[model samples]
Target: MNSETWQNLLHLESRDIVSNWFEKIHNRKLSARRAKEIISSARQGREYFRSASTASFAVRPLLAFYGVASLCRSLTLLHRWDAGEEGLKQGHGLETVAWSATLSGDLHLALASIYKLRIRTCGGLFSDLVTVTNSRTVWHVYDRAVPMPVDNKKQKLGQELCFLDILERLPDIGNTVSGGGNQKWIRLDDFIYSSEFGAEISVHGTPDHPVCIEYADAGFDLSKRNDPYNSSAEITVLKADENLFRKYLPQLIDTRVIRTMGGQPSPHLVSKFPQGSWFSQISITYMVSFIIGMLARYFPTHWSALMGGEKGDAIWPQINAAQMYIETALPELILEIVGNSIFDNKEL
Candidate 1:
């Protein structure tokens, strides 16, 4: 792709769009221009994102996405790792697990919008990486040719931040964690908070501009996620593309945190995101919907064909089962167990 194409892909005015949305809806000061640059890029990525079919199959994208980012220092990859195909596939619990999962794209967008990265590709030298995105320029390194880490970071070129590229590591976070080790997220913020829960995202400097990026909390909840496979699996992302804050997330909506505590051994412990799960599920589902909808339009009809021995007439049962697992049953179980634990701990 040419620079023009790359511009179209990466320079979408999503920030402006989202900022404007907030300005209009909440009457808050915001920059809609940021969202504008990445909308098209996000759409383009959707093409590859939804190509993933099953829960277990989605892990590749999820892990690979984050694996690419080194700045995401603390990640519970193993805590969230899926151990079995049954857990990855047969268990209808991934959607629940992914509720807190965040995408790196959101963080990247925030980083990129806040700070721009200059990508350069050179032969043999990692600093001069052979970036294929746009700049069709190849060259010898200004500095002596030095081997670079297999990772995507062009350290030689002074590219330090690692928020955005990480999402490319895993396809579906829930799959990776509960449903068998996949990674995914929708609504960019979901990615941010999930990736850096209780952790601070420290941004040191910017180009030409002397501004520093600060967040009260780098974490955004994955309550809303776009899941398209099953309607019951459908969950919406909170503040999907809305211009939240250039610096800090405004209100203290300890929703999912509450939910997390709810499922804890003690109620006093208090979950972090009571409402985040729903929001994460919704947004993630929305993203999945967009991907599935887009792909369904182009994919052969055979792709939609049911492989199950069960009759299509019994689809309602499947739908109900999905809802029970994703919506009602799972939530009830989570709350029944963790809610009390959270409350008890909080009291203590």
Candidate 2:
């Protein structure tokens, strides 16, 4: 189909109609008891994290991790409705329908958590969901348009091409594809590979040859002190960007890249912590060590400034030894501040 036809078919009206139909069908399958169970589970998970916030620093990380895991489980259960035989009978493949529902559920839960955390971070997480969903949606349409292929590889390649075709047309929807616009687009691979933690993952692709998947208004510059907390800075993909994103969809689905970018490896896997022990304990310890190292390296001048003069040579050795001791101990006061500011999502 031509770009105009595709656009017409996937316009706002069509989206609303299909979305409403899906919602009604999905809602009809949800029993009141099931809804109650989901709500109760989510509430309990939130409460666990809330209580953990007040607990000792060593314990909060464990609680937060479990709380996030529980929330994920709850979302998965909620999306189970979309994968039912009913949807399959309606011409949607079980996997495709289920995956779309899962992404929607994840976005919903992430938004709720962002609000509850009172931290405006996680915009990258939000954009990632949108990119995946849009790419999958375009691919689904293309698959339906084409004849079925017996070979799995051919089917996959065809789907990728279909996804790219849609992305090339995104500029029609107001996305800035060529000239630099207000919206900043970043390749998914670039964003992940360049991240502090993500850099450790062995992934192919460079800053120039990034995966096709792109996120608009990603707000990647976390260095700005005020940006993380700016609620007004919402992350979203314009209809145009969605159209343009198809160009890179195939590269993004490459098995090697997919494997590398799949999930955040548990920090516990590399730590010296004993098996089954609280992972957050080690996390907080590392965080403490990082902070102490920073302070020891940078605070001497600040200390002298606060004291109105530099320390005399006679006291230098004593001061250095005290700094070393403080670095090793990583006092509770500093740990508390770090935990609150970074982990708890509170403003620094």
Candidate 3:
């Protein structure tokens, strides 16, 4: 953000600023306390977007901008609370966020749900429905035509796919793909693994049975070597104290190289995994698809737009073509913000 943008953002009149930053911005100044308030509020809004349950709101710049802030916030927590002989507890993630977020989403108060998710990340708030992860990897639950990496030489999307048909999109679920391998996405409804952290249907911890199988590799071992996964490896936990975490997690969506503390290791603790992942967001996409499907069934019309229909009647080929347009546009909109975080190649 430029100094000029800061001046404007620092003098907002309302908490929920409209989506006009691109066009309706200009030079401005405000009270020092007021500037501080806008700064704080901006961070709060940004954090809310990162773990928001619905993708609908995430695309909005105000909320989407905070994706990095939210990720760093959770990383801070995972680093801090992971200490002592008791072991690092799994923190509730996306699965639980959707339930709370949905209630708020109904009222367009997704911000509250974001706040709740932040609390959950830091162990301040939790859900009884599921267990969380000790090491959280930000998983982008998307497929096909993903935005190409900015720095990566390859910009073309290597795969062509229909997302909803290819792999189920789990909105309110959590899955950990640690102990790396070339597992090119597979159905994860029932597979399992264990860790050295806490374990449960709704908690984060090491799976008691640390047997890993690399689905992507031609030949891989599915056996436990160290008592816990990565126990023999030198993996560092960044955030390790909950008390220290509250100070940093709710940061603004501004670009800053925010990192938590690390450099500690203790004996291994065993955690278990009954299943690889779980969900909470009531699969609304299915309903959306169904409703659209039913509309086509009851209000059946314009089937002439079907592919290669140009030879017959050119009824609504353009509208049908837009379906392809949206499939590609959505991912780019999401990645633009996320990519901002992944790269530091430009001005920090």
Candidate 4:
């Protein structure tokens, strides 16, 4: 695509369109918490776009559209919630739940878009990807290049963190674990209250920022820690001979770390790279086309109501035009970005 086309694609109409729409809706139907979640998701999508813009050219369009699609999905969910609440107030419980499930599925697709973009950028390197758990924990050692799974529920969010701890200890580029595996395993009580490690392990930035493991010791405590993951106590192993520890790292990970206490791997673990393949590209194009068609056919009146109340009719034409472009032009652009041969032959 030329520079003009890129500019047009990035031209998200006017910033005021979404902001005004959100403000009007926030004042009208959404609760404070729900409004906040919607705004936060929108902000995250923008942040991801900003981050993607700084990335190399090969994956820029994928990342940029991933952000745009995320914002679109969030707005669609907001619309669904607004439409569903009327029925909800009228005693349609099942219908309300169904609407919420649809919203959840949209959230899943937003994540999937990001996951595909990341895979394109990183060639599916597990270490470079950040696995976002259903509980919202973002697990990754690297700061950038973090890839989240499309389906959060299937991720082994907690075990992945443990697995990262093991990876951090391994002999890699720039990592040097102090006592190797032989460092004395700190007691759970000792590690938690140890003013030393406590001072070292302070939380910084927002929860979305990468978790810092600096100056932290990993050892298993027999008692459980106060974490949502419900991980076992005494899970960290501190001290072992360097050579022996290095030799057994893979075995330890395979036998103890990757699986849950129940000894089953997370069924939702995202191990396959489905994006950029011919089938995946076609599927995404078709899905986007279908959604655009639906919006054009059914959503203009509803959107007009949301944007301008009962008298709002002006916004429908703009929406219709946008949907038309999405159906006719956006699919080809997306296929061009994602269906390229360069992305197909990449190895993790």
Candidate 5:
């Protein structure tokens, strides 16, 4: 999650570490040709990521976005190797729908304009990535302070949304989204399950954060606590009937499983908006990076105006944090998916 922890798995500077990872992929018993394709794509992705490390902020988004795209291709090759080289070559599956002008000399209005920047999915590499990953874009919103999941009936392709919608859902830059201070990710310490005793969990987070449990196709449920739980309270008990417990336990365990940079695998103690439909962490990073990269590459004047403080002083910080986090987090995510696909079965 952090740079130091991520570096242990992704050593861009050292060929040996990367080779060690490739060796694991090779051991997956994939055909020689498929293994070669996966490794080659992964190597290209790593190169882009490594190159982005030294680039200036002005151009870092472009490099980082390509890095992520390449890594995504590598993942597609791994999961959908049957698609073959040609199938994987689908172009970027996303397109910008509109860009609204907001330079009316009002800082707040300019900051709000990020929401006007919109994009939608068409069919291409990004779409293939989504398909292989088994994820879809959704309209995730807060309802009465709880994150609500949009029904599958409402889930549709080509769902256009403003950049702010995506940015607000990202935990890394949640604080910077329109300068609002809401925590989107909370620490999940432990979840204990017992056939006889039912389940109890230890969730550590501030009282202000949304730390609710969702289960049995029901909505968010603040755990049954005699006293209000806060950061100081480490555990909360949940009692479920045996029939429901047996039905949902497997799903619960499956979803919470998380792998680290190391060989050891662990289950997350708390669920992140458990069972809620939201963009995968990778998709958010990829899309946000694409937006920044577009501004840098296609709208040089606008990018310069924001970067040079000609406009958007209020909006600048969020953009800066987004770029910084993407640079730091993308590789970790790429490797996490790689490791899960080839090394183990944990997921994001």
Candidate 6:
């Protein structure tokens, strides 16, 4: 996280600032009692993040996950005030139904043999948050030729999801989770808007490698505009008039608007997966953190072995990346969600 924004969040530790911020977002008469809870919850969440920053990777996930949970509680308070404190008391709304580790005669092999971990949604705080953000999928990150929502509406609660599959969907660590393959998120170099050709917006590919941006909607022309500098690079440009561009303006904005700690935004075009197989970035964060925290808390022997055993070298980098995401990216995401909920312009 940037130092300036981190300091700004620290300032919210002041009760007066939090209270004022809360009231400002609502722009209405405030509830003194609820205001106190929101202040306390946000403080608690920040402290957890602070503590997580100091801890070693061995135990960091636990602290970080709880910190995220606390922040989510604060957001929940802001969004679902009708539920009140009683709603905040609900369970995590997620569970690890089955996790199996295969054993070999060699201790190192046994330690490395964590075969599978699966979790199910049990309808609690986490589930509620997922439902609220379900509309914003990986599909929303692009303009596909066939613009159909991935049909996840019928996705049943309590249906188990492979822990690795969900972990593989994280925008940052996904490549690591996929055995060092291509990134699930393709970061765009630029989105150039031109009015010369009736307001044409070009989706530039990452300059470092060749990319094929395809399946644009009808009336939007897709031409092979490869980068002249790199013979192998493919740049997909979508052409549309000002009116048509306005139709996709919301999605285009969302695709580019990943805010940093100081409210600096970057553009990353995401890849789409099958319906019910993909999730929004926030849900992925919460679910992954929850799984790691649960493992650290409940499976002490295995967790310790996984951290220090033979495969540790390979796994530690991903673990460290997860921690970094929790520390830096997670807060920005929470702020974004809360800001959107309150219709606030700024995310502090």
- How many backbone collisions does model 1 have? 129
Model 2, 272-292: lDDT tens digits are 111111112222222222222
Kindly list the per-residue Cα lDDT of model 3 for residues 1-348, writing each as its tens digit. Answer: 223322343323233341122112222323344333434534553344333324442132223323322322322222222221133234321122233333232322431121122111122212211122111212222121111111111111111212221112221111122213222222211111122221111111212222112111212222222324445532211221223222111110100111113311111111111121222111112122222222233323222122224332322332223222222222222233323223311220
**Arranged by TM-score, best first:** 6, 5, 2, 4, 3, 1
- Ten residues in sequence with the least summed lDDT for candidate 4: 248-257
Off by over 4 Å in 2: 1-27, 82-244, 247-348
* Clash count for each candidate, listed in order shown: 129, 8, 28, 15, 1, 0
Task: Put down candidate 5 lDDT per residue, 1-348, tens digits, no spaces.
Answer: 245644553453344544455456444345556556666776777777777778877777788788778777776766663555677646777788755453334654554476568778667877677666542221111111111121233224676666776656554453536665444434344454444555444444433344343432333223533335454464443445545444443221111123344433333222332233334556667788888887678766666667777645566777887787776666655665565544443222
lDDT of candidate 1 at residue 155, scale 0 to 100: 17
Question: What is the alpha-carbon lDDT for the whole of candidate 5?
Answer: 0.54
Report the lDDT of model 3 for residue 305: 24
lDDT of 4 by residue, 86-138 (tens): 22122100111122233233433422221111101111111111221111111
Better of 2 and 6 by lDDT: 6
Q: Which runs of model 1 end up more than 4 angstroms from their true locations?
A: 1-174, 177-285, 307-348
Pairs clashing within candidate 6: none
- Which prediction has the highest TM-score against the true structure? 6
RMSD of each: 23.3, 23.2, 21.0, 23.1, 8.1, 6.8
Model 6 quality (TM-score): 0.69
Cα lDDT of candidate 6 equals: 0.56
What does candidate 2 score in Cα RMSD to the true structure?
23.2
Quote the lDDT for 243 in model 3. Answer: 30
Per-candidate TM-scores read 0.19, 0.25, 0.21, 0.21, 0.66, 0.69
Model 3, CA-based lDDT:
0.23
Greater-lDDT candidate between 1 and 6: 6
Q: Who is ahead in TM-score, 3 or 6? A: 6
